[model samples]
Target chain A: MTGESLHLESVAGLVRGLAERRFSSEAVTRHFLDRIARLDARLNSIVTVTAETALDQAREADGRIARGQPRPLEGVPLLHKDIFCTQGVRTACGSRMLDNFVSPYDATVVSRLRAAGAVMLGKANMDEFAMGSSNETSFYGPVRNPWDTERVPGGSSGGSAAAVAARLTPAATGTDTGGSIRQPAALCGITGLKPTYGRVSRWGMIAFASSLDQAGPMAVSAEDCAHLLRAMAGFDERDSTSMNRPVPDYVAALEAPVDGLRVGLPREWFGEGLDAGVAEVVESAVAVLRELGAEVREVSLPHVGLSVPAYYVVAPAEASSNLARYDGVRFGYRCKDPRDLHDLYVRSRSEGFGAEVKRRILIGTYALSAGYYDAYYRKAQQIRRLIREDFLRAFETVDVLAGPTSPTPAFRIGERTRDPVSMYLSDVNTIAANLAGLPALSMPAGFTAGLPVGLQLVGRDFDEGRLLGVAHRFQQATDWHRRVPPGFE
Target chain B: MSLSDEQVSAIAELARLSVPRDALRGLAQELSAILDFVAQMNAVDTSGVEPMAHPQDVPQRLRPDEVTETIDRARYQAVAPAVSHGLYLVPRVIE
Candidate 1:
């Protein structure tokens, strides 16, 4: 098969081609690496391209397939967001602090995918330390949306979403703390899943917010996401918060019928902040579910409006603690010269961190500070319980919640850069899922103007299998996920 | 609560980050605005709520006391900014 045919092939399709020797894995890997070299300069979606290692892995995969012994995901090429540490590869986390840092250990997600015979194309860029809603905050430079080069791809997994949408590789890994994966996947018009927290091990995935952070897949379709998630999800003893439950056969679960699935549409999601075009697109997507013989109902997650504000407090508070390890004396960037220990600590951090990261650190430090802990951190945690309870209550009536993944589709690159509040509000529809540690998937609903709108489906904890089944059936009925950008096509 | 410049600086110091002289005022203003937004939680009565630190509320798993890792000092220190005589070289803290 030629490079264009390979690029358009889904993960399942690529695996079949490899098994049938239609094309060698090395050829597939080269096709994507060549595309990254030729086209990534325009999108700025990649940080490091591991051409030699990828070629080496691809050759090994070809050997496995030729020997009639192959792993489930053998020979599929994919990119990992820079946040996951790939041993001996630069794991910058899209920050200047770790710009020169090469990890000595592979993240569990990276190693697991490698064991499954997946070849890593490269490390995709992201918002600095996974802190921003738009890709504009990356130290490497903003990742331009493939849909419109002038617009953002949505972040902090913006690069991953863009790469998958443009078919730079079949799939990529993305982490969602506060809508990083789902929001970007929606804006870029691809299938992205943020599995329930603890569903996937967090070992060696750089921590942004421990409680809310989850590693999952971004791919061209829900079927592809199901295959990738099957390989990526499992318990690990290394990650303290990793759940000990057995991972369900996600790919097998995708075939389950959604004939009587109860879909919930939270009234709060359609309130003031939602764009009219986005709401219309999401409703039409719901109508597709209705056509699938699923019952859709209006449910109330009354505390949903507080998601952004509560997320800002809780996420940053945990981030301050998680990011404190980058103190310059250890690994990461340091100031050229330091006057004293205090100066070393302060100057190294100030010089190394970007504006958004520093702002979050300061806010987190203040929230966790002695006198203000109850008012900020504790109260935010209490709000988190209320949000979780709201989901619990709604789940009693519905199997899953559906809404717009983002308030609007892709905005211009620099539109919300100066105003942090506005950027925080963009995550309104998606943050509640992260807060409740629920599984959420964002798939292309339709287009608004010229950009894609994402219809988000959120499932109860550990119910990702059911969520994927519903998404897979919807995808079978619609063609939105098949649409590619004008230039990318 | 809105923060003053001094308060912002104090928070920065505690967090071990330095705020540049010119940027302090802007940082303070931005942080205060964020704090005001987060203050919306105060309106909710969390009178009998338990603060959630982890999603699952699972207890921290403990293992048998044992040395699980071998010391690879060279590899560990390879990414450090400054190291000398098998020690990380930091500015002198004591006179």
Candidate 2:
């Protein structure tokens, strides 16, 4: 196939093209560079573009081919979520606090991807410190949905999601603390996976909620994501939370049929705020699975409704502790008038953090405080157990859980910005997966009012391999993932 | 879940934030609404439930307690707002 055709090809096709030497890695890299130049200005989706580095890596990949060496991702170009720390490149994390900060070390995921020979296409923008569910909190500004510029692309991994959705990059890394990856992927109309917590290393990723943070793949289709994740995931000594379990060969079951597999739909997800269109799309997605030899059943995750609240308290509590280091004393934002260490700490953090971040931090601090610990924080933890139990029990009767990724499709930018509660609630269904520490994915279901809606499939812990298998099969049966945003093209 | 204005103000202080009085109403209302949603946990009976902090049952990976190397004073100071004699400079706390 020609270079133009390859640009829009799935990551599996890109890897195959590189393997056959049909077109040099440099040619594929340049084609995407040209596309980014043409379209990124309008969407502002990609914050830091690494054209020179990408070309350099492409040449090295071609050199390896000259020597008759081959690797699965030898020439694949991938973008990274700005949250991960790259040794030299600016990893913005969508915050002014670290706007100019350059990390001296690469996160385990970055190093692993590089070792896999994936070409770096620079870092994508995200919610500053990976804090917000919407990209608006980013100091770099909001990433517009590729489907419609007026709508949000979702966040805190908005840039990664947009980059994958618009075909600016084949695959990108995204961290989900409380639905960051899944929500954004759902909004952007791509397949995004959040491996069970600790399944992926968090070594140099700027911490959000340490307990909840997980990095995984965002791509046009599940098969592509499987390849991308295979390259980036594994246990690392540097991350205390990194799981030591074997990284399963995810591609083994890409074509596996799910005959009589039971899928549970949580009652909490379909309640109140779910827009008719999004609910319709997700319900039809369940039907598609039913037709493909799966059984759909309604299930109750009684405590699932409390996930967002538990998450708001728990994530912020962890974030507050993790981010305490950025007090203008070491790295990141510092105030101009710092006269002493205390002033520096107070001003640096107050100035550096955005409103939503401050709000969450407040909630977290209160939850963890002396008199309120049992009332807020400990109680939330107890509720967290019930959410996990709900999922665990449901899994005994179901192969997987299904739901709409968000209550609504991509909403107009300013519409939800004025209401933070609405924005936080947008992550409702997806948070339970994080709380349960289960692998969850968001894949395109269908469109509503011309914008794409996402369907989330959550599986038991360490079952991402099966989740991808299910998603790949679903993608084979559908064409929604192939639809591109009109203006973006 | 109905966080009062005083509660929001108190929490902000604990988190070391500087919020103006006028903004307290909005923050309180929003925080209250969010807390209301989170309060859904109160309806469930979780007496025997054990709270899980991480998804995996795998034990936390730990580094040996041994020191890796000497600290890089210069690099550490690079991001500091003000460092004097390998120390961060700060405002005077003296009376």
Candidate 3:
């Protein structure tokens, strides 16, 4: 097969082709590396391109294949969101704080994928410390939406989503604290999954919100996500929150019929603030599921409206604590000519962090401070319980909840950056899933005004198999996920 | 619900971050708006609701207290900004 055809192949197809030796792993890796070097300048999606390392790994993978010692994901080229710590590579997390810091150890997800024989292309760009909704906050630069270059790809997984949509790599790893994976996937016209909290290990992935952060897969289709997630998920002793449960055979689960599947449409998501164009696309997508013999019904998640407010408190509070480790003395950016230890801490943080990260740290500090702990932090946590209860209640009646992943399609860069509150609203439809600790994914539903819209499927805890299965069936019935961005093709 | 510049400065100090005096006014306004936005949580009656710290309600798992990792002191200190004789060097706290 030619390089052009290789770029168009899905993760599953690439794995099959590699196994069949139709194309050598080195050829596939070179095709993507060439694409990244030629095309990534326009998108600004990649932070670093590991061409030499990638080629070396590919050559090794070809040797493995020749010796008949291939692993499950042998020779698959993938990009990791810069948030995951890749030893010896710059894991910037899109922040200047760690711009010069090279990780000494690999994140559990990285090690697992490597053990399964996945090759790393490089780290993808992201919002600085995963704080922003749009990718504009990256210190490196904003990632352009492949569908419309002037627009965002959604973030903090914007780089990963754009790379996958542009076919620079077949799949990439993405972490979602609040819609980081799913929203970008929606805006960029790809598939991204945010597994239930604890379903995937968080051992070395940089933390934005300890309780909400989850690492998952972003790819061209749900089946591709399944293939990637199988290697990326499972319990790790290093992560206290990692659930000790057997990972279901996600690829096998994709073959399950969507017939008799119960999908709930949250009434709150479809009501006000939803763009009319996106609503039409999501509804039509649901109708396709209904046509495939799935039952649809309206469900109430009344507390979801408060999720954005609660998330701001909870996420920032945890971030304030998690980010405290970046005190300039160890592992990250430090200031020069400090008069005292106090000066070192203050100036290093002030200079190292960007505006949004500072804003969150201050908010969290105030919330957890002496006078306001109960009013802000505790109250948000209490409201968090209400949100989780809402999902649990909905799940009692439906196998999964389906809705628009984002309230609108990819907005123009610099559109909402000035208004922090407006940027926070970009995740309004998706934040509740993270708060509820449920499995959620965004798959290409259809397009609106030439831009892709995502239909989000949220499932019960550890129910990623069902979410992927449902989305796989939807892709089979609709041509949405297969539609590539024009220039990339 | 708006925060004063003094309050913003105080919060920054608490967080161990330095905010230039000129930036405090704008920072205060932005933070106040976020605080105002999040204050909507007060509308709900959460009187008896338990605060959920983690999604998985599982208790923290503990393993046998043993040395599971080799001491890779050199590797761990490779990224430190300043070091002297294998110890991370920071500005002295006291004379």
Using lDDT as the measure, the top candidate is 3
Superior candidate under lDDT, 1 versus 2: 1
Docking class of predicted structure 2: medium
Interface RMSD of 1: 1.1
Q: Residues A1-489, candidate 2: write the lDDT tens digits.
A: 876767687788877787778888899899888888988876777888889999999999988877878677888898899888888777668888888787767899998988888998888888878877778888888888888888889888999998888888888999998889999999999999999887888898888888788899999999998998887778887788877788878877677788878898888889898999998898888899999999889999877878887887788788777766777766778888776666677788888888888878877786787887766677778888778888999998998999999989888888888877778888988888988889999999999999889999999988898899999889989999988888655
- On the 0 to 100 scale, the lDDT of residue A283 in model 1 is 86
Give candidate 2 regions above 4 Å deviation: B1-10, B57-59, B67-76, B84-87, B91-95
Q: Local error of candidate 3 at A309, Å?
A: 0.4
Residues A357-460 of candidate 1 have per-residue lDDT tens digits of 99999999999999988888888889999999999999999999999999898999899988899999889899999998999999999999989999999998
Q: Write the per-residue lDDT of candidate 3 for residues A1-489, one digit (tens) a residue.
A: 676779999889988999899999999999999999999999999999999999999999999999999998999999999999999999999999999989999999999999999999999999999988889989998999999999999999999999999999999999999999999999999999999999889999999999899999999999999999999999999999889999999999999999999999999999888999999999899999999999999999989999999999999999999999999997799999999999999999989999899999999999899989999999999999999999999989999999999999999999999999999999998999999899999999999999999999999989999999999999999988888899888
lDDT of 3: 0.94
Between candidates 1 and 3, the one scoring higher on lDDT is 3
> Candidate 3's residue-wise lDDT over B7-77, tens digit each?
98888888999888888889899999999999999889999999998887787889899999797899999
